[model samples]
Target chain A: MTRRRFCATLALCGLAPGAIATALASEGHELRLGLTPVFLDDQSIFLEAWRTYLTARLQRPVVFVQRGSYREIVDLLNQGQLDAAWLCGFPFVRHERRLRLLAVPLFQGRPLYRSYLIVPAGDTHTKSLLDLRGKVFAYSDPDSNSGFLYTQFALAKIRERSEVFFARTFYTWSHRKVVEAVAVELAQGGAVDGYVWETLQRSHPQLAARTRVVEQSPEFGFPPFVARSTLPAGDFKALQDVLVAMRNDREGKKLLGQLNLDGFTPGERKLYDGIASMAEKVANRP
Target chain B: MKHFMRDLSLRYKIPLRVLVLASITAILVTASILFRVYDETRNDLLRHAESMGRLLANTLVGPITHDDVWRAYEIINSPFQGGSLDQTQIAETILLLDTRGQVFVSTQPTQYPMLSEPGRLDPEYAAIVDLATDRNDVKPSVVDPSDSSRLFVTIPVISEGARLGTLVMSYPKSLFMPRFVDIAQRAALMTLLALAVLLPIAWYWGHRMAKPLVRLAGCMDQIGPSVPENLHCDLSESHDEIGRAGTAFKRMLKELKEKEQLEQEIMASERLAAVGRLSAGIAHEINNPLGGMLNAINTFKRHGPDDPRTLKTLALLERGLTQIKDTVAALLVETKVEIHPLSRRDIEDTRTLVTAEAAEKRLELIWENDITEDLPLPSTLVRQILLNLLLNAIRAADKRVECQVYRDSRSFTLVVKNDGTHIEDEDMAYLFEPFSRLSRNGHGLGLWVTYQMARQLNGGIVVESEPGETRFSVALPLQEEA
Candidate 1:
């Protein structure tokens, strides 16, 4: 029974989604989240919070990159342009061999979140991913775990290709853009980050109210803090320690609260194995 | 499952069918919308991509015509350096090809001049450039061949309609997905939202549409012969076909009940008419015996007081007269016939009618008649009754048939017993009913006719059967002369 429960927990977290390498090869001590505009609606506050916390803990100057698509951030990370980044689990798993696990955020005390498949608020026809075939769709990022990878995996499970299954698909590079596009009827449906969607519901009620979640995927490993494999061991440990202990410290906790998170937990390699298995399954599908 | 469904009442069947049909319709509509939008969105994406390529070609036209490779390089490289055409949003590669189909400049440094032979360059792009250079058409063109994964467009640098050089811009297949994914995601979301809102409304509407039918079914189930008149069905008030049907059904039930009652009344009147016929037959039989009895009484009155030898004659006469009197009393029919005093000769004549038949059947006729005076009842009915009973007994007896008649001032009783086969219990239920043939096969009317005549005379007939003896007895209330 315990083993079954363990397996169930593993399955719930999508430990096996997929893995790919980031593009940027130039490496440095700069840490930036390839945050599409949606992630840093006000970049100053977001960048300040991360820079102050990381600079104080790492004893190194930390610069945050606020502009760029998720793919750009991944490319920079791959080319060693950025030292570390807050990246979605999709890219993290994609570049599993090249990236090191730093830490994952704890939201509602779980290191997990979901992908929400959304449609226009007033639409009364679609019910599942299968129903959205040949319709215009929005994805948060090509490299995003919840935003794009899960949608691909879902299509693969049914032996369908996104190009044929959907009429047109495009990445917004930001979870917020996906929501806005769907809400404004620029797109008929979208795959969005659950956390971002929830945050938008609270932060921008009117925008969030324009669409409804049609599907909530099985819980998956949260997008986490990722660093290149070439990072110094001591520096990586310092970064992990700073995030994990964030809830325990006054300044850290205050910063986390603003982000609607408790703190961070130790990176669990096992947490993403389920996503890897999913990636394998998607690869194996006809 | 199919058999079970076949048995399902329409109340459930209708809702299930409606839900199934509606669900199928919803699915079909969603699928149609999804595929239709998908086609439209993809075409729109392709169009948009082509337009972007054309716009890029237009921007690079002047530099190529001026033979400014460095300036053309700056134009393509500007978009990569935070310019309007962001690197992620547009062309992956841009090149300026000279009139000789030699690459003069490109965004990538390694490919500054032609790296590969002209044949190595994209064949479709080379072909378009060759066409523009040869024809001097110098038109911007978007060329997307189905076999290739990359999108390429060619724009010839025109100086006074003279082709100077060509600008080639290329985007990989991945460039199309971002916009397409965004649009498709929104379409899917909208479809789901539409289903969520419409399905429930469909169910409610189906229920409302089937409501009258369900109610009508309930009414049909409750209807019975004994259902009360006041059990109201107000569904008839509605101005619909079902309401009209309810009204028709209510009328049908009322008419059926009335017809059933009328049938029962007609049957009773038929039985009464049958009884009247039986009584008339009995009265006719008694008339002959009554005339003879009056003559015998007149003879006795003329001679009984004069002769010495008349005493012996009187004893024989009294015995014979007593036999006649008992027979008439025993054969008295029901009360619907007017009472006429019984003559002593009626029993004697009825016994005489059966005596030969009993003798022919080798059965002894034991006639024990006790009646000796006149009684109030017509002798004709009595005669018919006695004759029918005696004939039934003679036919049934193996050796003997006994007819016993007795009368008091208040009542007359007659019993006919035969030593013969016993009547079966199953057959006894309908023994006195009309057209009942219980073994003897005597037109199946003998006992029923006798019973009806007896009923008319205010008397009843009963039969008791044992192993070797069966007896039919009838009793009538005696009436005095009016």
Candidate 2:
């Protein structure tokens, strides 16, 4: 028994301590925030600055859990591993029962953005989603409102299925990649977030110059910061307060500039009503 | 090659050799420098790619573990962004291979799809997978495949003693070509500049150095077994080796000239001695009989001739016999002679002796005497020399003869000139030798006798003949008898 206990203690010393520390960190002192590649450009620097800001204001260590697609972040947030996440409108409306809207990012002073239909700069005839029929298309993500749901909702209004409307389609999993696909002519057309395309035009003008915007969807609620429904009320309120008050702080405003955002607001649930209706329209299409 | 070089002229040989040696060294040095620069650039490019691979590998471990292809792509694509427009990206494509040897992510995702086998992507990557998947030691390796134009660097991504993935970065081999070409161009320009500066100096120095040697060689080529009297070497005055050699050659030439002069003098003396011996022998053999004949002629003139014809014949015999004795006496060169100072009258006497001969040809005779005092010379020898020259002049004259006598402090001089036809060049060589018949009148012994008389008096005679004038000049120096 003595030797067995010693071996068990050795095993605990070898491996269990790190696992225990990680578990305790997520539950007690650390806030694990999920980030999907939606409108984030220069991910590491922006994530680092946001983490520093949140850690200082909320008085807790902030850990940003970044993922390639919205599905991963949504899954983590629903599983309660992530306390909160910045997610697209479509995913938030679909998972509304498990997530709560913490704050809506203000882009150009409004908690609203639109989907942009883009084609190669030489494609002058493509002006609407109907004109992109039978062409290869790239979507930023399957669960994004601006990149996928809005285009599907528009197609559904004309009684069309996306798989049948476009000859081929693929997910680039990032809004910047959707713009890159259309810019390099890898895709004849693409659906991307309007904010990402506009930001890219400002930062990477040469890359954006190769692409042309054919259509802009009606304004929908911007992708918002949300918390898990199971998160502690104190932590949720603290995160929402920190995000909403970012415009009032100098360092927070600088970070918001880096993120190409005006500020954040505790927007109403009706702000995402347009995305909810689009998701419903796409899903209910026979 | 040695024989060929030996045959080349110094003018071309020196510069050619210097240019050849300099060109060879320049080519070798330039080639070596270019090679070194090429090697260094290639190594630097490869080292840069390797370090990039290592950094990407470290950064991609988290993204690869989480299956975040976007983050991995951004990490690999970072190097391609924000550089100058002219610069090409060093890493052409970067791939992240899972522990199962499948490409989990790639910078060129359309080309190398995710979850594809590494071998399916590229045959070279098949070998790279094995090197990268070495579990014991996951060291970074830079691979330059012989069959590809790309250089590959593989860094293994590890997390806590576990091999997470392999990061493979490929770089085009032509990335360093621009740098190498720049180095080569600079090296080539420097070599050409060096040659441009060095070649003309070599040519000018070669030309300057070879000039004197060429002159010396020309002087040497004119030499034979016998040296010439007026050989001149037009070499520059220098104290270098070739100049010293020229000096030695000139000294040798002088010695040879002196030796030749000595040899000619010895031969002339020997010939004179032989002639003296022969003349003495002839004089001994004929003087007694010639004396008896002359006595008989005188007796016939005084005692046997009473008829007019007989008297005329006796006078003719006496004159003929006296001429024979005089001719024999001329042949016998006298070694011992009574010395007497030459007076003005002796020279005047010579002019008088040649006046009748001059009249026979109807030649005008001009005589000018400038002597005021007696000259300390043998008067008989001086008078004989003067008379012989004047007679020869008269005989050769076409129109007139001129005799001039002068005395300076050191010597008494006589000049006789006549308007005459020029002597032939072939006849001039032996004009003073015995038995050289160069004229239509009188025995050729007259000038030979005059030459002998001048030598006996330690005087000299010269003859000049041209188209219109012929002159004979004699100079007799005063010497006190020992």
Candidate 3:
């Protein structure tokens, strides 16, 4: 009996480190990527496919973390719970001290997009934001550049406060939701991301056909993928390389096609100067 | 409706009644099954919604307690995102209300903003607030307010000791309609299929059942006051009710024919008796007066008439008296019953009497005599009956005349048949009446005399004529010697 017990002990000792190593490998190499509502809401399948692609390319496990609003994703990123996040330019610039830009999504062959001011299809007379006084308005998110900051800056330039210009306003927490609000006439006017609206037009034409775009803002830096500044350089570089080289790979190109994107670029910080200046102006308004 | 049905023919009425009854049963069964399906579906949907509301309330506890409006909003919106559950949207809107009955986080934030009173959004929301705050455990209820159609289910979010909030989910009532319609359609289809199979069977059975009755009715239509002897009713042998009716009708017709024959026989005999009494009185009165006149004329010729004129007058008077006596003798038929029993020779003598007429007509005479002994019937009346029938048959026969004489213990029968033209139905009615004028070549008094003689002897004569031949049958009951 003593000999049998000794043999059993020897077998357990031999299997312990292998099990521990497998567990450590599975838990430590997983990358938790955060997605904000600025991305389309109905892209769970796309997200899954992209996660699989990323895991295969980076030689590690990957997971996607989705939140309703940009603020939640930004908070998670700031708390170091997320390895990387795809966020709007406004939040990246606002928390530039703790976050570092990893990649910028290229739309229509350039890393720039625009914000739109939309109204119900029947509102023919409302050509610009000035004509929308006393009307209900919807905004995508406070941390959204094209969805929120651009509209605020435009209102500031006209010397009108948003609270006073519109009779009522509410945050929809999503660019697609902003379009939906305008389409359903829940809000007479709304601000949305042009790229998100265009993508929705392709995917759900009947829903997009309910609203009309009244104005398009000047081009601004697209929403970018970013990492926390404290992330290891090697891990950051690995994620950046995978994103930037997506156009050169077949699987990544197909995923990009589903996302309605051209490619990704390691963009410069000066590319978001227009949004940064607009944010500063909105904040410094009297 | 009763009159209408009574007037309808059995052929159409039977199938119509069966169809109406089957249709009523099918409709009732279909309605009941559809009602059950609707009830169960509604209950199942409500139960499913309640369970969903409870699970959502539990998940919202942490978010509601921490004041994470976005997380709570995302949790409520998750059910709307996936199309995996079903084609229909489960919930129209979901709301999270704070302990103060304020809208904390909602799927439609723009409509129901944070920290706003729930009642201000819509009047119907007041019911949800009341339900959430009224009891610790909120029950699901269908609330279709005037403006909107919705079914609301509320679940309270509670921690270890605190009630953090209420999770209210309102599903559009339209979602249950598709399931109800589906079940109703299936039930209706099944009912139609069953009716399709059963309706034809009912019709066939009804028609088969009504067929025999229709045939019996046709047979009844042929029956008149003067029922024919050869009426055919094929259904009498069957064991069904209609067959029994047919059997009864046939028996009634037979009795009617017999009664009609009896009445005809009585009329013929009564007429013959009346004629006999009148002729006998005439004969008696004429004979008495003529005898006296003749005797007086004879005495005058012998004693007082010596001139030529007196003699001529006497002779004329005698001739006139003799003519009157002879006319009266032909009219009188002897009513005396003869005591001599009928012999087979008497029946044979009829053939001899009609032989000359038959020879003149080129007719073959057939004689079938079965009797060898005398029968206790009057020979004179029997001889008269045989002579009248044979003479009539010889007159009417085309090529052949038949005479059959037979006797049993009770009666003597004679049958005379002639192959001649059939007797007309109109002529046959009065064929045996005196002076009928329906005979082919002679006065119709021969059959009348034959009928009278047969009746006097307590016998009957029946005539049956078709296209092929005419037959006369006389049956005389034998009497005891007096």
Using TM-score, give the best candidate's number. 3
Better of 1 and 2 by DockQ: 2
Q: In Å, what is the interface RMSD of model 2?
A: 5.2
lDDT of 2: 0.80
- Chain B TM (all candidates): 0.45, 0.59, 0.67
* Residue range A1-286, candidate 1, lDDT tens digits: 1133234334422322232012112343444433433243343445455656766676555555543356777788788777778887777787888999888888778988888999989777889988887777778766777888888899998889888997656665578778876775646789998888888888789999989999999988888888888877887788788789889988888887777787899869888876777777776778
Model 1 misplacement above 4 A? A1-42, B1-482
**After superposing candidate 3, which stretches have Cα over 4 Å from the reference?**
A1-286, B1-37, B63-71, B87-89, B115-120, B136-148, B158-165, B180-332, B338-340, B343-368, B391-402, B417-430, B436-444, B464-470, B479-482
Which residue window of length 10 is worst by lDDT in model 2 chain B?
Answer: B81-90
Candidate 3 whole-model C-alpha lDDT, 0 to 1 = 0.80
| Candidate 2 lDDT score at position B139 | 82
Put down candidate 1 lDDT per residue, B1-482, tens digits, no spaces: 98999987665666567666756775676667656765665465456545654565666676666544334555656556676554444566666666776665566534333323343544655555565355455666666667777766666655566666666666675655665566557656665666567666765766776677777777777777565656665554576897778778778777877887668555654665565566456655765676576577567757657665775676677677666554443333344555566767788888888888887888888889898887777787877788888888888789989999998767898999999898997776567655456645656566766876787788877789998999999898987646
CAPRI-style grade of the A/B interface in model 1: incorrect
Taking the tens digit of each residue's C-alpha lDDT, what string does model 3 give over A1-286? 1123235334433433454447547776667788776667455557657876887788776656767678888899999999999999999999999999999999999999999999988778887899989877889887899888999999999899999998767777788878877876667799999999999999889888988999999999999999999999999999999999999989999999988999999998998899898899999999
The global C-alpha lDDT for each of the candidates, from Candidate 1 onward, is 0.69, 0.80, 0.80
C-alpha lDDT of residue B197 in model 1: 71
B115-208 in candidate 3: lDDT tens per residue? 6677877888897787666646544455556576777777778777577888888877787688778877887787778778877887788778
